[model samples]
Target: MANKTYSFYPGCSSQNKASSSNYLVSTNSMCQKLGITLNEVPDWNCCGASIGYGGGGELPRIVLSARNLALSEQHNAGQDMVATCAACWLASREAKERLDHSPQMKADANEALKEAGLEYKGQAQARHMVEVLIEDIGYDALKAGVKKPLQGVKFAGYVGCQTNRPFGIAGESFENPLYLDNLVEAMGGEAVKSYDQKVTCCGGALAFSEPEKSQKQIKDIIESAYDHGADMIVTPCPLCQANVEIYQGEVNKRYGTKFNIPVTYYSQLITVAYGGTAAEAGLNGHVVAPAKLAEIAGK
Candidate 1:
C-alpha cells in the first residue's frame, strides 16, 4: 500500500531532548517503516497542557489548541491532525469537540484567533496516531512490518488517560484498552492480562507538586507490571512515558522498593521490531532503558 501522510503534532516532549525527545526519533523511524508520513504542524505552540485549564479561562485554552488546528488547515489542509502525546491529543481533540459542537464557543475561540491573524473554521480532525495505526493501518499490517518479534518478553500496555477519557479512540475500552495489548501481541510479545492499572492516571504534572502521592501512583503502575511478569511497560502518551519512567528511581528510593522496569513508547518498540536500530528508535535516550526487550530484540 502507498504511504499515508497527515499533519503531525509531536507535542512538547517529543520536540526536544530536554524532555521525551526519543519519542520524536522513535516515532519518525517507526512511521517510515510502517509507510506513514508525518508532516508536522507548522509553527505549532503549546497546547496549554493541564495547567492551562486551571490557570486560564476557557477561551485561552481553546485558542491555544485552535491555533494549531487553524494553522494545520491553513498550511496542511484536509489532513487529519495526529498527535503522539496524549495530553496534546486530548487538548487538541477537546478543543475541536468544544469548537465544533457549540457555535458560540467556536465563535469565541475564532474571535481570539483573529488576534493571531488566524481563523479556526474547525476544518481539521483531531486524532491519536495510535488510532490511525489501528483503524487505518491495521494490526495485521503492523505484524507484517515486524522484522523481529519481541518473543516471550511480557509487556504491560499502559494506556493512562487522554486517549481513553474525553473521547476514546475508535474501538477501545476506556477502562481496559486492548489496542496496546493487541499491538504488543501482534508484534510477537505477550501482553500480560493481569496488569490492572491499564487506564489509571500516572499523576501527570503532580509529579512535581506532590511527589509522595505521585510516586505512590507511579510505584503501583510499575510494580503491577512487574508483578504480572512484565519486563517493561509500553504506552502511547509522552507524558505517561516521562512521568512513569523518569520517576521510577525516585519512587523506588522513597518507597524502599527496587523497581527497575523500563517504560517505553510503543513507537520505540515498533521501530526496532521492524529492523530499525536502537539509535533510530531513540532507545539510547530511555530513562529506565528497555534493556529487557532490547536484549531480546538485539538493540
Candidate 2:
C-alpha cells in the first residue's frame, strides 16, 4: 500500500489526558497498516473549545483554528486535517464554517493570524477519525484485515454531541446517522439499538463548566442505557469516555442505579476485533473493563 499522508490534529484533551495515549498510538498503528500516514500539525495550540469562543470571544476561536489549519497547509501533506479530540474537532469545524460563510470574518481572522506567521485560507478540511476510517478506508478493507471478529459481544453505540450536532453544517445527519453503528457491525459486533439519548451529549464540557444540568443529562443518559439493557457503551470521542467513566460512580450514587457499563473507544473495539487483546487496546485502563469482549469476539 502507498503512504497516504494526512495532517493530524491531536487536540488538547489527548495531550493532557495521558490515558488517551493508548487511543492515539492505536490509531496511528491502524493508520500505518491501512497506508494512512498521520502528519501531526506542529506546535499546535488549543482550539479554544469552550473557553476560546465565549470568554475571549469568537476571535480566539478563529485564530486558534486558523493557526492549526495554516500549519497543516504549510506541510502540504494533505488537505484533510484529521482531528482526534471531539472538542477540537467541533471548534475547528465551527471556525472553518463561520470563516468561510463570512468573508469579512475570514479576513479579520487572517489578519490576526499574521502575528503567529500564519493565515487561514479555509483550504484545509476537518474530519473526525471515525469519518476517515469508515468512509475513506471502506468497510470491506477493514473487514479483510480483521484477524478477529466480535461475534457475541453486543455494543451500545454512543455518538456524542459534537460528532453529530449543529445539524447541516457538520455534514452529518444527526437523527439518522449510521457511521458509528456501521463501524461496530464491520467489527462483527451486534450494534444494539438503544434509546434516543444515544446521540446525546456526554455532559463533559457542561459537567466541568456547568455542573447541575450536566450531571442531570449525563445521569439520565447513563441510566437510560442501563435500562435499555446495553452490555456496554462505545463512543468515538475521548471526552465522552472520560466523562462517562469518571462520573458513572457519582451518577449511580445519585440516581440509585447501576451505571456500571464499560465505555470504550471505537478504535479500541476495532483493535480488539482485529485479534488484539485488552492490554494492547488499553481496555484494562477503562473504568469498566469489557472482560467478556474478547471471548465474545472469539479472540
Candidate 3:
C-alpha cells in the first residue's frame, strides 16, 4: 500500500505522560507498520472534548475546534485532520458539521479565529484514526501486515458512546459497530462476536463527578466482558479505555466482584500483531497488565 499523510490532532489525553500516552505510542507503532505518516497540526488546542457543547456553550466550542482546523489547513494544506481520541474526533467533527451547515456559526467561529490570526475555510475533513485505518487502509491490507497473529486471544470490541452515537464511522451500525471486531480478526485475534456491551457508555467525564453512577456503568461493561470469556477488552476511545481499565479496583471494592480484564486500545493489539515488542506496543502502560498480549509480543 502507498504511504499516506494526515494532519494529526493529539488531544490532551494522548499527550506525553498523560492518561492515554500509551495510546499514542501504540498508534505510532501501528501507523509506522502501515506506512502512514501523521503530521501533527501545529499549535493545536483542545477540542473541548465530549462536554464542550454543554459546558463551554456552542460558539466557544465551535471556535476552539475551528482554531485547530484553521491551523491544520494552513500548516498541512490538503490533508485530512485525524484524531486518535474519540472525544477530540467527535468534538472536532461536530464543530466542522456545525460550521458547514450554519452560516452564522461559521462567521462567528471565523471571527474568533481572527484573534489568533487564523481563519477557517472548512477545507479539511476531521476523521477518527480508526476510520482511516478501516476505510482508507482496508482490512485485507491490515491482515497482510500481521507478522505475529494473535491466534487465541479473545477480545471484546468495546465501542463506547462518543464514537458510535451522533456521528459514527460510515457503513457501521451505531448500536453494534463491528469495525473493532473486524480489525481484531484482521490482526488474527478472536473477536467476541456476541459481546453485548460493545456500545455501552463508559460514563465519560461522569466517571469523575459521579463515581458511583459511572462505576455502575463501567462494572456492567467489564462484567459483561468476563461473562463472554474475553481475554481482553479493546476499544478505539481513550476515555473508554481509561474509565474501564482504571476503575476496576473501585468497582470490585464496591460490588464485591473480581474484575481484572485487560483493557487495551485497538492500536496496541495491531502493533503487537505487527511484530512490535511489549515496550513498543506500550503494554507496560496498562494498569492491569495484558499478559496475553505481552506473551504474544514476546514470541
lDDT of 1: 0.86
> Quick one: best TM-score, which candidate?
3
Q: TM-score: which is higher, 1 or 3?
A: 3
TM-score of each: 0.97, 0.90, 0.98
- Candidate 1 error regions (>4 Å): 296-299
Cα error, candidate 2, residue 104 (Å): 1.5
Which run of 10 residues does model 1 get worst, by summed lDDT?
Answer: 290-299
- RMSD (CA, Å), candidate 3 to true, equals 0.8
Give, for candidate 3, the lowest lDDT window spanning 10 residues: 49-58
Each model's lDDT comes to 0.86, 0.75, 0.93
**Model 1 per-residue lDDT tens digits across residues 229-283:** 8888999888888889988789878988988778888888788788888788888
Q: Write the per-residue lDDT of candidate 3 for residues 1-299, one digit (tens) a residue.
A: 53999999989999999999999999998899889999999989998987666789879978899999999999999999999998899889989999999999999888888998999999999999998998899899889988999999999999998888889989998888889999999999999998999999989998998999999999999988989989999999999999999999999999999998899999999999999999989999999999999999998
Clashes of 3: 0
Residue ranges of candidate 2 with Cα displaced over 4 Å: 1-3, 16-19, 167-172, 294-298
